[model samples]
Target: MSVRSLPSPADDPSTDIPPPPEYDGNLPFAAAGPEPARTGGERLYVAMTGAIVAGPFLALGVGGWLLWGRLIHPADLLLALGLYTITGLGVTVGFHRGLTHGSYTARRSVRIALAVAGSMSFQGDVIGWVAIHRRHHAFTDRPGDPHSPYRYGTHLRGQLRGLVHSHVGWLFRNERTPADRYAPDLLADRDIRAVSRAFPALCLLTLALPFGVGWAIGGTWTYALTALLWAGLVRIALLHHVTWSVNSLCHLIGERPFRTHRHDRATNLWPLALLSFGESWHNLHHADPTSARHGVDHGQIDPSAAVIRLLERLGWVRDVRWPTPDRIDARRA
Candidate 1:
């Protein structure tokens, strides 16, 4: 199936999902507060964020050394692929679509399981992640957005700087998205709270699991080390950039065919489609946030939607807000 093209005017989709709260374009574009002073707790937070952002990068050098010595193993590649698919889906399907937007109603067990899986991605606790994302939606590409590529401005120099800021720099900032204000539903869910609390432990396990499995399969510390590098560190890093690309590149680049709120410039970036589980069809997501499917047009592959469909078929989820042809057509530009 080919992707359908629409004309250059926009229409709103007819769905129950309300548009994100709109803000007038009067807020300051620059960061509003004095730089946060780093206290003991703040220091630790920055240190951990640094490690999460940089550790996988450092692993790339070590991986290259291993490859030079013929120490790379097929099991490591297989393990990395498996873990990447699982955790990536956990974020795209569970954290973003299900929890953050209520795209579908999952069974209690399924909901908790997806939350646990997503926490292992080392992104953040589920509640915090959802809260931050909700805030982004509420103020997309405008002043209050946590990571808009347009944060700096629309000029060339600012766009370049904003790209870096949106891609990863904003993670180190002290800006906080309050759960009570943005994600009260997740905050009130006992199962989700437990999963959020387990985030640190899950981060450790995400690394250690590959090591133990590698040793079991390959029978050596060398094997375990390689698995730790590729499956553990490299996989996390790859997913990090892919997810961030949705925030940065998805906004500044690609085709925008759907009507979103003023200043919401989300786009359909097909190059990132498979790796991001169809989330790169971000224009549609911003156009109709509660739709169970983002890649509503022909030939736009959306693995997360497929997973949600499977769960619905298995009775693990219901009330999926799948888009109809009319809804899709109405959203055309």
Candidate 2:
């Protein structure tokens, strides 16, 4: 029996292959992960989704301070920070690790809550989000990767162009990765499908939630509006930039402790450790997507992993893919 050696990460399958076809519905999880190497374009007709929201965010933040002498109340500050923690974990733990990679199995209720909380982050609908992310992994830094920062050549102008596109310009794109091809398991999950559909409603609810709490506490419209601006808009803006930085800065400049043979440009940015919910451990993530804990080393803080650990103790998550020493040693650059 001839055992096949794993392909060197430097030797990514670069040829364009057709994306996997849709199954006849209800494919099991193990069989549904994206296969290797598949694929298109540059454009300026992008929808600018993030920019549109940021305009309003900046306006509210500055205008409120100038006119009302208050940009955010103390309660508003707390509300934003608290919600940011929840929704950020929802993306890092729930969406990226649990749902997208099956890094762990969560209780049905916990899974559902994670999806709902992830929707509150306003990143994308569940199915679409999974599809785009899965496609990103399947292609990595190769041509077909949806968010590769090296889309343009590595020359100065090309790098600049590529950075912009990868960071947020991709948001303007009308092209979407087909869920059946990249995220078939999520598409097949009824809970995920429902959450994907409820994205718009969830957005409304998330934004309104802080306002409601503030109004109830203070019994004033001023407090309600202030909370809405800070917790709702400003918080979204902050998380957006942090999440986008993974696609942008993490790929460009950071410590590459885990060598991936240039298959992709993921790096671990220690500065982003806390802000990104431990997701700045990017090189490790691309090296082993199924590992539930990305910050594998001692002294590295991973609040999301801590959450998963707590849940595991409480029987809320199982089959966590904590990195073993052997696995870590094998992947060291």
Instruction: Report the number of the highest-TM-score candidate.
Output: 1
Overall lDDT per candidate, in order of appearance: 0.85, 0.76
Which residue pairs clash in candidate 1?
A: 9-333
RMSD score of candidate 2 (Å): 8.8
Q: Compared with the true structure, what per-residue lDDT tens digits does model 1 show for residues 1-333? A: 000111111222321234334433333375577876789999998898898899997888888888898888999999999999999999999998888888888888998889988898889999999889877887788877899887777777878888999999999885888888777777678889899998989999999999999999989998898899999998999999999999999998999889887778899999999999999999999898878899988899999999999999999999888999999889788
Question: Over the stretch 51-114, how does candidate 2's per-residue lDDT look in tens digits?
Answer: 5446545845664674476445788889989999999999988888888777788888999999
Look at candidate 1 and tell me the lDDT of residue 106.
86
Q: Give, for candidate 2, the lowest lDDT window spanning 10 residues.
A: 1-10
